[model samples]
Target: MPVVVVAWVLLILLGWSLVYWPHLPSGFVFGSGLDSSARASWTDAVYLSAVTLATLGFGDIVPADGWLRIAVPVEALLGFPLITAAVSWVLQVYPALTRRRALAVRLSLLRRVDTVGLVAGQRSVLAASVLENLAMSMAQLRGDLTQFSETYNVRDADQNLSLPAMLGVATELTEAARRSAVPDVRHAGELVEAAVGDYLDVVDKQFLRVGGSAQKIAAAYADDYGQRIAPAVSGG
Candidate 1:
């Protein structure tokens, strides 16, 4: 997103510079006491445009003519809001992205524990506690998925840590728990499965209402998981 904003800024600067280039001789001026040999070129126009848009008044260049006087300040005024909005968007998005990554990590850990327990046939109290904790984590993750679906605006395919991926992980963990001989683990797995189902329903409803890139991402993720990751994780 920041890259998009930067591209837009560059394009804006280029456009304004091109518009001002032809008018430079009559409408633009360099600072006083500069050499007479210094004349406005395309490069100079571009530099001035950047300076004005960034509101970086180095004062080495100035607009001398009437129309340019209005134009330069208008560019400077636009600069303030544009830069502020970009910074504010970054500040808002970064934390949300960080939280999503953290949740993915936590789910990965839970899946690992459950897989190990299923393989080892462990029936200890510690295993039960782990199952309980996994169930709780799945519940929390469901809520997080709801928030993510509600708040996130799909910008691109760059965001790979999505609700669908997390759902796949949860499904694997539930299957692991179900295969275990321990009754408590089986019950916990059922709880996780139920929570996951509810969350998936919400995701489906959201996809139906707001069908776009997000829905495409979810469908692609599900297909990939079903064909590749699911068989590997399920030992099929």
Candidate 2:
């Protein structure tokens, strides 16, 4: 969001400089000496820049230069891309943050249930119930990621199906755990733990993949071909 704000500020200054600079009472020139008319116009330009950057466009200063005329449309062009990148970054990070919070909640709930089961020595029943809740939460996360993939088209290389496939495997494990009623509670508990571990691993990989995709899209949107995120080289 700050990046977007700064971009708009710079863009607005560019527009205002291009606009009244040509038609000022003193002259259309950079670094002109300040006089009564020049200072007032300069202040007006500053005001206009603030409004334009805020997208207020208060109708005070208008462009008059023919050759410098392209600034208005150019500012508009730059604004949209900056705004889009800001929005996309929010969209990518917000869901991942939400999922992390949800996962923490699920884990806490499972631990409470586990303690209760151990106290009652009805380990298998409690474990199964915990597994069911975890499964449901995982299913919800899968649905959220599916919508993300469809909206962003980030997984288009695999026909937008890789995440769905991974989620399906998680669902299958949960279903199997739900159906098993073995007498060995320890074995059932171990199976559920293994399944959860595997699901977590898959989810981690998917997150890495999606994060990479978002970084690429954002850099492209910024027109940063030189990889500004690259580590700086130091002299030996």
- Residue range 81-176, candidate 1, lDDT tens digits: 789978887676666656655655555554554454452366646655655665675566556556555344432232234444544666666677
> How many pairs of residues collide in model 2?
0
Clash number for every model?
A: 0, 0
lDDT of 1 at 13: 91
Write model 2 residue lDDT over 1-236, tens digit each, in one string: 44555776576676665565445633323333434354445655556455555455554444446543456555545556666766786677567546634554444333333333342254566655555555555555545554453322232122112232223233333344444554444455445445444444444454433233422433332232222221111112
The most accurate candidate by lDDT is: 1
User: Model 2, poorest ten-residue lDDT window?
Assistant: 227-236
Question: TM-scores of all models?
Answer: 0.56, 0.41
Superposed on all Cα atoms, model 2 deviates from the true structure by an RMSD in Å of: 13.7
